[model samples]
Target: MNAPHTPASVGATQRRRWWLAGAALLALAIDVASKSAAAAWLPGRPVELLGGLHLRLTRNPGAAFSIGTDFTPVFTIVAVAVIAGIVWYARNVTHRGWAAALGLIAGGAAGNLVDRLFRAPSVGHGHVVDFLYLDWWPTFNLADSFLICGVAVAVLLSMRNVPITAAPSTEGDAVHLADITGGRDGR
Candidate 1:
């Protein structure tokens, strides 16, 4: 049996949705701005930074280190699906951490999707703008950073057994692991 949502609970869920949207917009804005700056300023003039980091601009027609270069349109489609999934899942989020995590993921995906839809080469097949670089790693952008960090947060929350919605057993108190995983054995 499912418990009916109270007015307070509904309000909380709405707040979580706002958090998700805010985080996504913030991440998307930063990514788009940074990419534009990189495209405008970092061509043929790499700048070295601390810790072996460099500001170098490159356009990638593929996903992650130029892999699957032939599947740019597929990537765009996947990104759109992922963003939609995040928005759908966020509707029931009652946890602030989960809201932020989903928001960042959606924002990052949208950031790259913008590039795929509008940047360089052709529409729906444009290259992603990558600028930040390290000698040992493929060049990445702010969107990638947001995606990585968001996933990391989500993993941590899952490992801790954080509940997405309020559990009836907790009665507005802190959620416990058993309330989420059933027991230590996860059964």
Candidate 2:
């Protein structure tokens, strides 16, 4: 039988960490790239996708729907805190599912954080580039989509009772997801 703290277990944990980091990086890259493209081609104009779907490049100085328009610095601080929290949790990610979910959240947060730090107007007071405009929906970007989707996924996981906490060590007693979610055998 494999020991809890064996090198193999450690390797598995490392792999899990890589999964989270990789996913986050990929999401961030896509968000950044899409925003750049939108800025380049959609500025000052709107591109109709479907009937009500459109891309209208714009900069938002506040949170969703332009709330707190004068609190760019505050938003910047929140983003920093979020990124920090994600990093801290990432150190002990035990569930692959949570890794993916957290990755999306981290990536999305990082993307917007980047804009808040470097976009325009001033450092930590810059506006975020938004381009996606869906029927009657607030203008947003790839980062926003990722963030929303991530939250949805997280909620679903929680509903299913998937354990998101990490064990103190590979040798430590870990909670079995099957037990928490109730196994298919209904044991």
Each prediction's Cα lDDT score? 0.85, 0.80
Candidate 2: pairs in clash: none
User: What TM-score, computed on C-alpha atoms, does each candidate reach?
Assistant: 0.87, 0.84
- Which candidate comes out best when scored by lDDT? 1
Please list the residue runs of candidate 1 whose C-alpha ends up more than 4 Å from where it truly belongs after superposition: 167-187
Candidate 2: stretches off by over 4 Å: 1-4, 166-187
Clashes of 1: 0
Q: How many residue pairs clash in each candidate?
A: 0, 0
Candidate 2 residue lDDT tens string, 1-187:
5336767557656766787799889999999999989988887889899989898988999975567888999989998998899889886676676777888898998999899998998999999998988888888888888888778877867877666644323433343555335574485
Highest-TM-score candidate: 1
